[model samples]
Target: MPRVSFVHPKGESQEVEAAEGSTAMRAALLGGISGITADCGGEASCATCHVYVAEPWIERVGAPGPDEDDMLDFAECERRPSSRLSCQIKITDELDGLVLTLPESQ
Candidate 1:
């Protein structure tokens, strides 16, 4: 399992152990982390699972794929260079200790 950290908009945080090959959104939801909605069920068609990869983890998470990038434009919250859909991020051993920050709104 890989440990992942999620920082709430208000500055609260939680660390969770996630299985390899699972999506970030799923891990968040399972751990009761509210930031990621995963409304489209990780299909890449919905923008509800929006999140920001923490600055240091940005490059490690990499940029969203073309389809995901397109959906991000419609995200309810403001997007940034680090904006990404949690459903699109897969957890791996290499991602152990990955950190993600939640936007105030979805």
Candidate 2:
């Protein structure tokens, strides 16, 4: 399992272990990480699972695909260079200890 740390805007955080091949959104939802609403489940249709890949983890996580990028434009919070839809981030051995920051809103 890869452990992911979810940090909120105010600096609070929660860590959860995600099953390999699963998405960060699924893991966060299952772990009860509040900031992720996942309104469209893991289909990538909703920007509700928005998160920022902590600077150090950006390269490892990479940029979003075209489809995901389009949806990100609808995120409730302002988007940044590091913004990504959690549903688009797949958990893997290489992603262990990845850190994601949650925006103030979905």
Index of the highest-TM-score prediction = 2
Q: Write the per-residue lDDT of candidate 2 for residues 1-106, one digit (tens) a residue.
A: 8999999899998999999999999999999999899999889998999999999999999999999999999888999999999999999999999999999898
Using all chains and alpha carbons, the TM-scores for the candidates as numbered come to 0.95, 0.98
lDDT of 1 by residue, 1-106 (tens): 9988999999999998888999888899899998677877889887888988988889889999999999999988999999999988999999999998899997
Tally clashes: model 2. 0
For candidate 1, give the lDDT of residue 59.
88
What lDDT is reached at residue 88 by model 1? Answer: 88
- The model with the greatest lDDT is 2
Worst 10 residues of 1 by lDDT: 33-42
Residue 5 in model 1: lDDT: 92
Global CA lDDT computed for model 2: 0.94
Model 2 clash pairs? none
Model 2 lDDT-worst window of ten: 35-44
lDDT of 1 at 37: 78
